[model samples]
Target: MKNDSGAVAAVKARANIAEIVGRYVTLRPVGSRLVGPCPFHQETKGSFNVHPDKGFFHCFGCQASGDVIDFFCRINGLEFREGLERLAAEVGVDLGRARSDPRAAAKKRERDACLAMHELADRYFRHLLGRDEGRVAREYLERRGVSAEMIERFSLGVSPEGWQGLQTVLRGRGFDDDSAIIAGLLTQGKNGRTWDRFRGRLMFPIRDGGGRVIAFGGRVMGEGDPKYLNSAETPIYTKGQHLYGLYEARPVMAKTRRALLSEGYLDVITLHQFGYGEACGVLGTAMTHEQAKRLSGFAPRVDLVFDGDAPGRKAALRAAQMLLTLGGACRVVPLPDGEDVDSLLHAQGRDGFEACLERAEDGLNFCLRMVRESYAPREIVAWAGEFLGGLADEGLRALFIPRVASGLGLAEAELRRLLSRPAKRPAPGPRPGETAAPRQPAWELAPRDAQILSFVVRRPDYAAHLAGAGAGELLGNADARLFFARLAGLVSDEAEARLTEPETAFWAKAQMEPPVSDEDAAAFFEELCVFLHEARESDRRRSVMDAIRLAQQRGDSEEALRLLGELQALSGRGDE
Candidate 1:
């Protein structure tokens, strides 16, 4: 059934917040609100409070507060839509087979048609895997250490080279050729020809949280340039949004509150087969923001298991950025230079894999180390500042300040001064009957940055005033920088554009403030420009100091003195 606001309200109304929370945590009666140890973060005392009457939860330990739907989404690693569907199923409320709206209903019909095609195609692929031509695919899997039980559990299939293998099966099931193509099972070739998309390959069905097969990933059994192929974006499937083995892994992750992230489909299957049931992998695409958010919902933490090689380390860094950007907890499991999860498990067994995980570095520390390795010594602080600025928690950032400075070979006091500037506070919640609240940033934007963006968003031409003002450099907060950039992009076609979730709420808050008169705008803009100039000058002084330190390290007294002179002049305090 397609969901609507009414169906959501009905499901939430019927569902007991306490009962749902009780499933994951041990709660005790604490007056009106129930208290428990927060599942999202570690706590020695019960700081997680749930208000059943208000239908909301707030964790004092982590400051995490949300409604029932948020709880489901965070705990199960499901998207908003998937979470609603799950809660609806739990509460026994039907959202209707199609939404009440006609346009949505039409889209739902198309999605349903695609879903039916995938279901039929799954059977066809599985049936074909049992045939003579499928022997090679089966043998290849067997050699790769996949068991018959796992093969059945994962619903492994084979797509033969014969162009019409899948096409024939879909047509037999009364599914039209158009439906098959739309479902991503069949491809339209040059000259209006139709053929199977995955041919002579081992097929792995990618399922949603409900175990509904939505897409397929195929790996060639024989020689091919692209070793692995996945379904294109379809009416029902977005590759980056669905992970291989997620459906199987979610249950275990929910219980354990941890998940192992691997590089490929087989790595997830192998890990799960070897007693690591909480393992999942991204589809063929690079890790995405949606994937990171969804994974964070399934488990509070994810251990990224990549090949211990240059490319693997690089991939881990990219992944860490995404997770950290969203304030998701993660660890980077460093393998031997040539090893991956599957190969390591195959060679060293479960004990070896466990040892590797034990040595996993916290995602932040790993990211910091990566930055130190990649950037020049003089530029380390700037990069570190940028990375640390992405952190959502002010307390967490404070704790890391010393380490970041140490990593950059700077004093703690100097680093603290450099990073201690505060950002704007969160806007108040929406009033009754207002639109849904926007997603809040992990860290607030600086007030000046917020004001500048507010004005620029409403008056697009104002962005021109930021040129040569060091506006970008002065923005120490990542969220502010992102909002500023988004605001700039919105200048053209302002009517059709929609602000990002966080930006939407942020803009709403901005609109609530008294309007900026033309006189205030000019003065405010000039003040911001002055602040930007001073901020950029301070940054330059720090760069000079860094250069001086580097010069001294290399025993270059002359160069060190010259850089020190530059720093003194920039600071407007001549060397004493």
Candidate 2:
């Protein structure tokens, strides 16, 4: 639909929650509910509980509970509208492809128009990449060992020498400054002049899992200074948390049960073209735990492919430490010195690369071997002693205890003594066992709301019992009201009941069918309800006091005054 009122609503109408959830995890029946391992947070035991009667899922372990749509949003990482279309398709609901509200409808049309302009900008850049105008850009990539297929696979494009090339194209398509600004295509200079964020560089459009053009990362073609430019973190693109080639590499990563994590866009593209389709790359920063977890989510084993140079090795080693702690096989694939993954893969070809991959060492073993090879015999013992202190459990320590002796060529007694070095805390740190208070259900309004919801849904009569209870009196947020109302109206057989779950934003958006942060919405609703309840009690006391004052002014007898005082106290204003 070009535009419409409650655009979210139309999508929700057709989205099927059950069908979508079914695609991922197997659902099994247990009492009136279906229980399965939660996807948002990983756990072997079934913490993810689905209640068919309530049409929502709750993870007791992580405090993650949400309706069906929210589950899809969190699991697939889709925007509100996209999630709706997916779920709607699953349920066979018809969304008439257009919005009815004129303002919203117009804005929708304008958004598409801006997106079309961006597409045209990409096309123009792509056209330049193949021509003499883009010779420098083409040469730069060629030097980096990126092939033709790699270029096309990543939709590599180029910005021309001129400043207004993209602006002109976008303007011609009827897009305004607001449009380009929103898409992260344009930035305003100090002098109020607007210019392209990415200029005269190779452009890589970073897509989400669904393949929507979310943002771009650009690499400089000629020697100008600042080499790589990425779309400043926008609403859609989050660099530290996502990999560049993930959209393309996910299926392969899943099938291969491994993710080849590198450090550049071209690195992944080159690897993919060479049939290492599982290869993905983090952006221009240290790989984050979020990125590592995302990689682990798709595949438990990730081969950290870095340039085999000192800098690359350091990065790979750091990644190993972080990822190993996160629980996965973090293998370090060290390419030849001075050669990045792209160059090595190119020179050796796919077969050679696959052979190198076979030699990939486990993170712990790689670290230990590298440490022993670089340090003296005494230094090795000292280092091992210090590092072993990092091991938390005996099982974890046992994993490396035996390996340490063999790697260092030491006796079992010597190695055990080395690994069992006296544990000491840094000046300002907790001794072991000093973890934060376990997360109990420190929840406030949400629990009240959940209870109220269960009751209200069970007895629609209770909604009337909670009439003057401001939006807060009911649930944790304003959206809870919307969620309840939506559930109240659904034709059980036709509607996606999975949406109404408390932890999901999908149902929150579906019921409200608009842009609203359920986080803020829930908090506001809770706070507001608390305020209203306090105010109501205060008002009751004030009314009693006012009556007592009137009785005193009337020169009522002592008994009358005493009676009035007691009544005022009973109203919670004062004691008799």
lDDT on C-alpha atoms for all candidate structures: 0.74, 0.65
What is the per-residue lDDT of model 2 for residues 498-554, given as tens digits with 9 covering 90 to 100?
Answer: 433332433322322333355754554466567677777776767767776777788
lDDT of 1: 0.74
Off by over 4 Å in 1: 1-10, 13-100, 324-329, 377-382, 410-576
lDDT of 1 by residue, 1-576 (tens): 011146655877888989988876778998878997676664446888887975767775566665677677666555566567768887898877754456755765788789888888788789878889789988998889998888998999998889997788788888888878888888897778999898888999989766888898899987895799988889888656777888888668757878899889899889988999999997756677667767775577789998877778877887886687556678999787677888888889999988988999999789778877887866676666666676677876776778777866778887766667634322223223234335655757776667667776555456656634656556658667756655555223222222344565455444435667788778877888778778778778888888988999999999998888888888887857
lDDT of candidate 1 at residue 472, scale 0 to 100: 59
**What TM-score would you give candidate 1 relative to the actual structure?**
0.66
Query: Which candidate achieves the best lDDT against the true structure?
Result: 1
Superposed by TM-score, candidate 2 places the C-alpha of residue 576 at a distance from the truth, in angstroms, of: 23
What are the models' TM-scores? 0.66, 0.63
Residue pairs in collision within model 1: 77-297, 77-298
Q: What's each prediction's clash count?
A: 2, 14
